[model samples]
Target: MLITKIYKPAEVEKAADELRKGELIAFPTETVYGLGADATNELAVKRVYLAKGRPSDNPLIVTVSSIEMMEKFATDISDDARKLIKHFWPGSLTFVFKIKPGTLSKTVTGGLKTAAFRMPENEVTRKLIELAQVPIVGPSANSSGKPSPTTAAHVYHDLEGRIAGIVDDGPTQVGVESTIIDMSTNKLVILRPGAVTREEIEEVLQKKLDTDHHEVGKDETPKAPGMKYKHYAPDAQVLIVEEGKWEAALNWAKKQPYLVGIMAPGIEEKTLSKNFVFFDLGNNVEQASHNLFAGLRYFDDKKDVKWILAAGFAEQGLGIAYMNRLKKSAGDQFFID
Candidate 1:
């Protein structure tokens, strides 16, 4: 087993040194923590998949410190893409583009002609990439099919002793993944919804973007992560509680044979029975999005919690991203009675 070190925000140079040595390190983004590896080093990239138990065919996102670094592999940047990058590059948006022929290995691109690229809003991580002198492949730093890690400790919980180090920069703000748009073709497809909403991207481009590209066939490779696999699920069964259904959901929860977890915004703790464990989702959808993954992780430690009744939001803005992950965690199961 490898000794996994936690690097303080001041110790990014040491973390970069690990990446230079072709090691796996988990680093924070504006979204979730991402498993970092030298994108040009095929062996290092393969180890990332092995460490996360991720399917090799689900392509990883290449994180760059600058547009020039992205230009090293990504080809045919469109005017619209440039516009989005100019506005959102150092933010929560990821773009999937055609790669320059043979610039990235099939390991990174998953045997596809295109790859996903992003320049995270986090300065420490960007500096780590700049110092390492190579783009890094950054998949969410967690075990496959689990909720993405939102804090350095969460990464250590899932990946301790399996990775080299973690750059601890506190909890992530977005608490979910970036919005991924496929600019590889002219259609401009949204492969995943995230903190960067389609409405925001459309507002930037002055044109409506396509969002119906998430479905993939059994044998097909996905254009971006989260499209082709069951993701963000916890060990406990999660049942989504839609709006106006909390009363019914809680009542239903009271009768379950096993302990139930309540993840919502407004419920008073005193009103609940001992069978229910409450996790606050905060006052609004933004708070819910920020706390969704952490709440899911919290209940995972409570071994007796067999079911999580999480609140659901309307599919708009960050709600779209929140519900996307919540739906996956719940396996699309909702409280019906």
Candidate 2:
């Protein structure tokens, strides 16, 4: 497949037209680039699965231009969820609600009663969704089990031959997935943490948010799109060092006999051993989030690295979301030492 590059409005519109005709279009979002297809079209949505080789059991998040567009896909929007939508829509927050029967494709919803939906803040993606006049089912642009794409270049690298077009709007700002909240129940359950922190959501709802991270075994059924599988994994093994153990962790890391990768903040890259590849992204949480995936991808591609060692962040605020992704990527291999 030809991966057509689009930078202008007219080009984006042409690409949107192609999407309306059931062609796959990869576009940028504030969080990550998305592989999009017309949500209402079963065949178009199916192409997204074929292109990404994503499991049918995993659902896709539908991106719309406005609340009206979201209404078309959802059967009922709860009062608590509506408050979140009013504030967090056009941002990096996805709400999973009951789907309107026979309105959206069953494949897009993964044969489940609930569908994940969001309206992205990215102008290009919002415009494309509006111009296409259909909800777009968007999963991360990379093939399943790989790092999510935060830059258009990442998208091109992973999906060049698998998709039709890519909108190169530069690197994403948030550099993480959306906060997925299930509003179907009276209480809000955080399915996945991202840019919108749980505190932020709980403050608005005036209620505590439920976060269940227990993994169901392979024999058990999955409750959400990201629950059952190991996702966002790099080619190399990743081990996260617990908080208050950075110095010991670094000492232990330096003594390792194999090539290693370390993601640290405010540390001079040159100070680390020449055998180590250090990803220094400043001491701020924002900068760390932006560089996390890129650093993982870098280590993943290295020929000699045995594993990647990441220092843990504070468990408060956005740090919670950051650690969630790290834990998911590391899975059963995660060690607190």
Candidate 3:
């Protein structure tokens, strides 16, 4: 399966046509590249799992062209959820709702009663959805448990012979996954945090959003795909530096015997003890969120590196979401120095 690269509107339309025909298409979103298939087509959606090696129990996020299209997938929408959507739709927020009968497939919904849906802010993704004239199930376009792809080149490198088409729209601006909120119950439960923060969602809904940490280690069933397992991990062992210890941690990392890779916001230190690869993801939370996955992939490709030393961001606003993913990727192997 040769990976076809599409750039112009004509090429996008051609690829979208293939998507409408039930073929899989890899397209870019602000968060990450998504391997998309017709959401209503069970067979088409299955191709997404097969192509990415994603488990059947792991669900996919559905992308729609508009709120009306998104509503079609939900059995019922709460007033709070609607308000949040009004304020954050076409962005990096995903709302989980009860699936309407005959609207989507169990494969796309993970055989659950509810479905995860988002309307991407990316122009190319929206255009692809509109051109295809159907809702599409879009999971990050990489093998399951691997770092999500943020650029066309990343998608091609990981899935070149595995998928049929990829829309190379350059690097994704928001380099993380969507913030997932479950609207099934009265209280808003944050299933997964990403570019969107709980404070922003609560501000729009005027209600406190509940955080669920139970999914962190439950062996039974995961509420969302990311909750069940460690994801966005690179090939190297990753260790997260505790907050406010960036300087000390960097120094210690340099003294380590093995080659080290450091990903920090802007703090710089001398590299003397070992070979190092450093990435400065601007001081702003948005910039850090946009570069998280790309930096992980960079270190993952470097053969000389044996371990990754990452700095912890302040758990305020989007920084909290960034740290959530960072901690999860490191798993229980990380500690404060």
Q: Which of the numbered candidates is closest to the native, going by highest TM-score? A: 1
67: Cα error in model 1, Å = 0.5
Give me the overall lDDT of model 2.
Answer: 0.82
On the 0 to 100 scale, the lDDT of residue 321 in model 1 is: 90
Q: Answer with 2 or 3, whichever has the higher TM-score.
A: 2
Q: Candidate 3's C-alpha lDDT?
A: 0.82
After superposition, which runs of candidate 3 have C-alpha atoms over 4 Å from their true positions?
A: 216-219, 269-274
Overall lDDT per candidate, in order of appearance: 0.94, 0.82, 0.82
TM accuracy, model 1 = 0.99
Give me the candidate number with maximum lDDT: 1
Off by over 4 Å in 2: 3-10, 217-223, 332-337
TM-score, each model?
0.99, 0.94, 0.93
Per model, how many backbone clashes are there? 0, 0, 1
Once fitted onto the true fold, the runs of candidate 1 whose alpha carbons sit more than 4 angstroms away are none
Please state the error at residue 169 of candidate 3 in Å. 1.8
User: Which 10 consecutive positions of candidate 3 have the poorest summed lDDT?
Assistant: 215-224
Clashing pairs in 1: none
